[model samples]
Target chain A: MTTAADSTVQSAPVRPFAQALKDAQTRITTHMDARLGGDDALHAAMRYAVTGGKMLRGFLVLESARLHGVAEAATLEAALAIECIHAYSLVHDDLPCMDDDDLRRGQPTVHRKWDESMAVLAGDSLQTFAFELLADPRIGPHGLTLIRGLAQASGKDGMVSGQMLDIAAETATRPLDLEQITHLQNRKTGCLISWSATAGAVMAGADEAPLRRYADALGLAFQIADDILDVEGDAAKVGKAVRKDADAGKATFVSLLGLDAAKKRAKTLMEQACDALTPYGDAAETLKDTARFVISRDS
Target chain B: MTTAADSTVQSAPVRPFAQALKDAQTRITTHMDARLGGDDALHAAMRYAVTGGKMLRGFLVLESARLHGVAEAATLEAALAIECIHAYSLVHDDLPCMDDDDLRRGQPTVHRKWDESMAVLAGDSLQTFAFELLADPRIGPHGLTLIRGLAQASGKDGMVSGQMLDIAAETATRPLDLEQITHLQNRKTGCLISWSATAGAVMAGADEAPLRRYADALGLAFQIADDILDVEGDAAKVGKAVRKDADAGKATFVSLLGLDAAKKRAKTLMEQACDALTPYGDAAETLKDTARFVISRDS
Candidate 1:
């Protein structure tokens, strides 16, 4: 029996993954620039923080929204909101008090560019901006649901919780075991990805389970790929200090599972991710390409 | 002539300011304790950061809501939400990169109690939690309005913008002039207070002009009073360091206007605050009492 997914696959022409990703990045930046038009130093820093990222999470939002027939305007807002959140996390994580990285997205980090105080305020403002963007009336009736979901995915029990666990592990007497590492990664990176993937369904008021399953597998694959890149990729290609995780003796997937096994695991998970998108059939081809790119890209 | 304001004042029996303040404090704390039940370090720091404040903002929300006949349960959530935002600001402002205060509300600040990373995460979480609370269905149909208002009030253009100006002023060649200082104070502290006071009107879809007028006067008076307290308040009573602004040679109402003139100005503003609440009449007795307390409280 032909399913709705099969019909959608046949009817919807697939856009190239790279073009789709580029479109999301351009649209989100334009939207952000329009909203954050102040000439103040704070606005400048906020704009700086959100620039030059991969916009993969945002692409996920736009693509998923397209699959679910959510309005493009609302989807674009959600996409930009997630980008703000992602950028804020990066800014804070690069703080001297946290990871203390000097570089992000091939530029001096927010703190290094200005001062730590500016970085803190910029990050803080960006987080608030994310929620503000979601509260826009264009987001339709599901605005509150989207707001609550983003809060849950990024706040204490989700991204922040993951960050705390990672910090605690840094000083622990013993390295984290596989299970602990998985839990940490899930919280630290997985939660936001899951939220982004499932957001379209939430917006469309459709079932989110398939997207959730797709995201869970995809998020782990993404992280495992990150580990592989940390060990094997060039610093310039990765756009950050590679081998730092190993240098810090951090118990990443590669460290725990061995590089070869980790790569295999990421591959298997990427396949699982693609399989989970069967409901969207060929309409989800770009998403399938995204899953492949997550494991394959250097950055 | 009988007006709605006059009738409301006559019909609504006045509750004692202290008793109403205490009730708001109790309800907000109870709600917060229930919501923040996790035993993790992040939760612990969040709970700690929110504790021991005067709960003045929360009280303002509850009182404003009461005047408009908004549901008590929903009002309580907004009350707690504002408190969370207030506490988060305090926590972040006290970081080493910012104001660097060690003591807050007669207790060690979050960074001193835990570490900088934890403080950052906790503050970040609290901010997100504030938005999350406001997104609750319990907050009724005006939830989106409240969320948008809050984001506008506290984000880059509001509280954070004020903070940036204050920091910039610290290093400027000359102390801020009266006009510049007023602008800074308006953004830093005035915006949130205005949002809180007018929340009832927003929620009830009533006119917010009177409350906005009351809050504008009250917020300015509140800042002037803070300047006075900085000069005259004992550290013990104030619950934090006093006279730092003078020592640092930071421009303040007390410094610019002289202590006596500043006191006079605060008193005049307080009266203005009270007068603006005439529409609410006796129903606003507690709020008028609050206005009086703003310039009079030692802390």
Candidate 2:
């Protein structure tokens, strides 16, 4: 936060969303590698768990920063930090005592690849590392705001609450109604997505209402698409098991609304999300495509 | 953080270190209770995990802040946040995949009291809660510094690295040498302790050399005392298992230096810790007493 890196150019053309995502992936991978150090097993496991994410959250951060004319140098570590939080959540959620998944992102989960202890420690360390990255002086004074927001978004009031509700629902005699499921998804998946989508506005101290609206609708659509994929996605393309929601007898968008209705709902949400971006006009073309990709992509 | 609670100052003059610790315990417990919300199991588990313990780390933060003339109201939450981090560490450390202890602070561990999933989520939530507290605007501009320092002290480079080393030592063919054990102990216990003990100087933006030196020596002494407690302290009094370190054949101050030398080392370190506070003279009497308490306590 000592001095702003002196660049405010947003001159890069709107690349293909696919290519933008790839660029984000590359930048974040390199950023993360430079951030992590030590030769211990925990360090190795941390690197392992942080690898191979879709980088959608990271992309959202970068794209949002670009839209606001913020320098990428100032935002790249912020982008990397969010990915660390996301990756850590995945690591812990896949532990034996939690989701117990053996595979994630087409690779063995952290616990499976290293051990349960490694997963726990790696996830714990990664969580702290995210905060450390935010503390980097390069992120500017707004870094504290981001750190606080991230904590609130990911803690009991947000993602953890969603996970907790999911666990409670798994054992409850009654199935969750739509309202309840919505509340869960809003916290579990929507919280981080919303944070990422609005990060640029927070950094710029600009109005976030439009972006918030965009993210709210877009996050729901994203979850709905995840539900759709759960029902129809191929394992080879999805990179993990499919039909998990249905198999668990859990309530999801598709289970509450019929598959056809769920698909329709997602499309409507995508439209709503795009409409929220009218404030940005053509500059948001890639974001609009991102909303489409959320539903269309296999993984 | 919104408002300072009305003060009910302790009327008693500086009494025994026991009385001081009890005061810290009562304040932190009440403070934490107010901070937590919701009736869900996750919230309950979080409260449960943080309920007991000596509040030693919390006291260090509050005392350090007080030493710098920081108002009790301003530093209370910072103290609470450090305790939250300490509590989260204990909860995670007791997981089946980690230390796997069923008992902590003389009660069933979080996992034992609830379940493994609850423990995992509670610990995760608590970690986030710590960051949230640091972000509160009430913490002043230095909130960013606190957040950053806490991250460094607790992340892979600090506590996690120490834990990893300890675990690695457990499986190593040879016992860790004194230098190796010193490195592990410094990270696992010393880092956060040092942070807490120097928090006041940081908040005051004052020279930290003296407190830093005091903490460096005190932290090592604290660990040596813990090593002694593990060997000779009563399980009932200690509120956890005793002699487990010896049973595991873990290289500790006692194991490496023998009982007499370990005790002598702790005393010498305690004296060195007190000596570092010479600049503050009688004002640091409580801290000097704390150093003594660390070495002499049964737990």
DockQ for the candidates, in order: 0.82, 0.74
**Each model's iRMS:** 0.4, 0.7
TM-score of chain A of 1: 0.94
- Over A1-299, each residue of candidate 2 has an lDDT whose tens digit, in order, gives 10012111111223476787888899989887877877767888888888887989888988888889777776888898898899999999999898889889889999999899889989999999998888888888688888889999999999999999999899999999999989999999999999999998888888888889989998998998899889988877787888888999988899999898998788788778878999998898788777777766778
| lDDT tens digits by residue: candidate 1, A77-127 | 899999999999999999999999998878999999999999999999999
Model 1 residue A156 lDDT?
A: 95
Q: How does residue A134 of candidate 1 score in lDDT?
A: 97
For model 2, state the Cα shift of residue B31 in Å.
1.6
- Best-matching candidate per DockQ: 1
lDDT computed for candidate 2: 0.85
Q: What is the lDDT of residue A29 in candidate 2?
A: 90
Clashing pairs for predicted structure model 2, backbone only: A1-A137
